[model samples]
Target: MPVITFANTKGGAGKTTAVLLLATELARMGHRVTVLDADPQLWISRWSEMSGEMRNLSVISHVTMASMETHIRENRSNTDCFIIDLPGTKSPLLTMALGISDHVLIPVQGSAMDARGASEVLEHIELLNRKMGMKIDHSVVLTRVNAMISTRSMLLVKALLAEKNVRVLNTPIAERAAFRDIFDCGGTLEALDCQKVSNVEKAMENVRNFAYEVLRLMPVRVVRSDRDGKFLGRKAA
Candidate 1:
């Protein structure tokens, strides 16, 4: 199984929203996903409560630094992927989660251009690499990008990140009402009613691309089991 952590010390950077989209999408693809709701607000846990028993999806709430590794070890038997949603402010858990994560996804708001929070995370990763020699794979996922934004502006954001040698995902998460609606409705994008939600199809496509890119970047070996007729992820020991 692969552990993917979303970290941004700055609040309102859309970290939790990104986590929800990726977790649901991965579960929809038949991979069992366990989300550790480390955020104090417990947004993911609340969303899971609103969401009725989704197959291959589970949420562990009130997670702490001490419990992080224990949750991973205990859930390793059934979990295909572990996603940790960290708090918005800088804390010890931020470093603790990053230390265990296979990939740290730092969500940066597009309109706000909140690079400071993302920079903090990047610096921590660099420090770990330099001081402890721990190389953790990570990326910046641009979120809440306006659909009407100019091509020039989007390119500029890309240019700025590239200038700093930051690796970013090609698929940017667009600002859409459907993304907000999911938190209220408590269901996956595919389950959302097309007539009720506007631009739902486009939102689904964007999330699909994002999830596919992450899967490609961190390829987990999936095995087929005859007993349950479901896939099991194999992690290297």
Candidate 2:
């Protein structure tokens, strides 16, 4: 299983939102997903319950650093994908989550303030990797971006990318109220009313593509799909 964790050192960086959306998308695509909520706030846990798909979804809430490693070791065999929703700040629990993650996705708003905080988190991750001699794949996902505001910040982000050698996914999530409004309803992006905001659909596709790229980088196995024995080729990373 590929264990992906959504994390950042700053609050309100949209880590929870990214995890929820991406996990839902993967689940709808037929992957057996297990979401581990490592945040003390338990926002993702609450949202999962509100989504009313808990019975069908594999979601474990109120997980802390103390218990996370054991849980993963015990349950990893049964899951195809493990998506961990982490707290926004650095803590022992957050560090533990990163230690075990196959990929660490840091969602940042397209703003200088958010970028600065994200850089700090990246530095910490690097330090940990060097100290422990463990390779932890990491990337940045830009969210709540608008052409008007992003035009300038995007340039800043590009400059940082060049200087720091950080990877930024090509897909930028646009600012939309629909993203927030859909949480109360039970569905993934595929089940949303796409007619209202087609852009969201495109954004989601970008996310899925980025995820596939991460999977490719890690060289994880892509399972083939068989619908009533009509075999489809292995899914491309």
Candidate 3:
């Protein structure tokens, strides 16, 4: 399984939202997805509880540095992708997760503070690469973007990432009411009521594109077994 981690050293950068979108989308696409909720706030865990049981999707709550690897090792065979939601602060867990992850996604908002938080994460990854020779794959994904207009701060953030030579996904998670309502409604975007939420279709499209970009970076290969008519998943080489 390819472990993809959503991490930022600062909170309110839409880290959890990105995690949920990717996990739900991948699960909806028939890939077994396991989410490790390492955030102490337990947002993902609470969402899972509210969402009840979903097919092809599982959430492990209260994951810590000590239990992180054990959980991944135990669930490796069954999961096609492992999404790790790290806490929004500077912690040792960030380093540990970075080392193990196949790709680290740092969600950054259109503000200086968010940029600084992303910088901390990028620095940590660099440290791992330089000090330990662990060149972890990573990218900065812009989140909570205004769909209608590009603010000056957003442009600056993009420029900064370009200046730093950081790879950023072209697709950005738009600021949508449906993105927030999913937390309260406790279901995937497909399960949400279009009548109750404004621009639900647009929100779903954004997530679809976001998930598509993520899968492009870290793909899961599924092959069929001729004898048993079963499908086996492996991380793409």
Candidate 4:
């Protein structure tokens, strides 16, 4: 199973939103998913509980690193994917999650300030990769991007990090009220729109594709994709 941890050193980076949305997308694609909520805030956990019936996904709260690891090890055999929503700041739980993660998705707003804060998280990942034999996959996901801002802060950061050979997913999540409003109602992007707001629809499409791309990098089971690039399975794997 692939274990993906959404982590960052700074708070208010949309970590919970990313985790909740991504997990919903993955589950909708038909993959057996288990979400481990390491944040003491339990935002994702509560959201999952309130949302109720998810087809093939399960969400559970694990406050400590030890418990998280134990859960991963014990349930790894039964699950096809594990998505961990971590706290904003560094903690023992976050460290343990990183140590066992197959991939780390760091979501940041497309701004100079957020870019600077992201650097610290990137540096720590680099250190972990070098010091330990762990090969943790990672990528930077640009969030809350405004198209009017011609100068793309995320693109600039991607250029700067090119020398390090880090990969940035092509799909940049644009700022959308749909995303912001969905949290309160516990709704997924897929459930929100069918015809209107094409941009938001396309953004959700990109998110689904990006999730598959991350899975592909890990050499996990390739999800069958149709001509439109949408995964054909009930969930992504």
Each candidate: what lDDT?
Answer: 0.87, 0.73, 0.91, 0.73
Clashing pairs in 3: none
Q: How many clashing residue pairs, candidate 2?
A: 0
Window of ten residues with lowest summed lDDT in model 2? 224-233
- Write the residue-wise lDDT of candidate 1 on 94-211 in tens digits: 9999999899999987433467788899999999999999999999998888877745555676777899999998888999999999999998988888899999999999999999
Whole-model lDDT, model 2:
0.73
Better of 1 and 2 by lDDT: 1
Better of 1 and 4 by TM-score: 1
Regions of candidate 1 where Cα sits further than 4 Å from its true position: 111-113, 151-155, 223-229, 232-237
Q: What value of lDDT does candidate 1 attain over all alpha carbons?
A: 0.87
C-alpha TM-scores of all predictions:
0.92, 0.85, 0.95, 0.84
Best candidate, TM-score-wise? 3
* Candidate 3 residue lDDT tens string, 1-237: 789999899889999999999999888777788999999999999999999999779999999999999999999888888999999999999999999999999999999999999999999999999999998999999999999999999999999999999999999999999999999999899899999999988998999899888888875564323344345545454
lDDT of 2 by residue, 1-237 (tens): 778888888888888777777776666555667889988888777777777764224778988877787778888766667888887776877778778888888888867778876887788789887998877788888887773465777678767866888888776666665567567555666566777645666666655775565556553654634544232334445
Put the candidates in TM-score order, highest first: 3, 1, 2, 4
Candidate 1 similarity to native, TM-score: 0.92
Q: Candidate 1 at 116: error in angstroms?
A: 0.6
Give residue 31's error in model 3 in angstroms.
0.7
- The lDDT leader among the candidates is 3
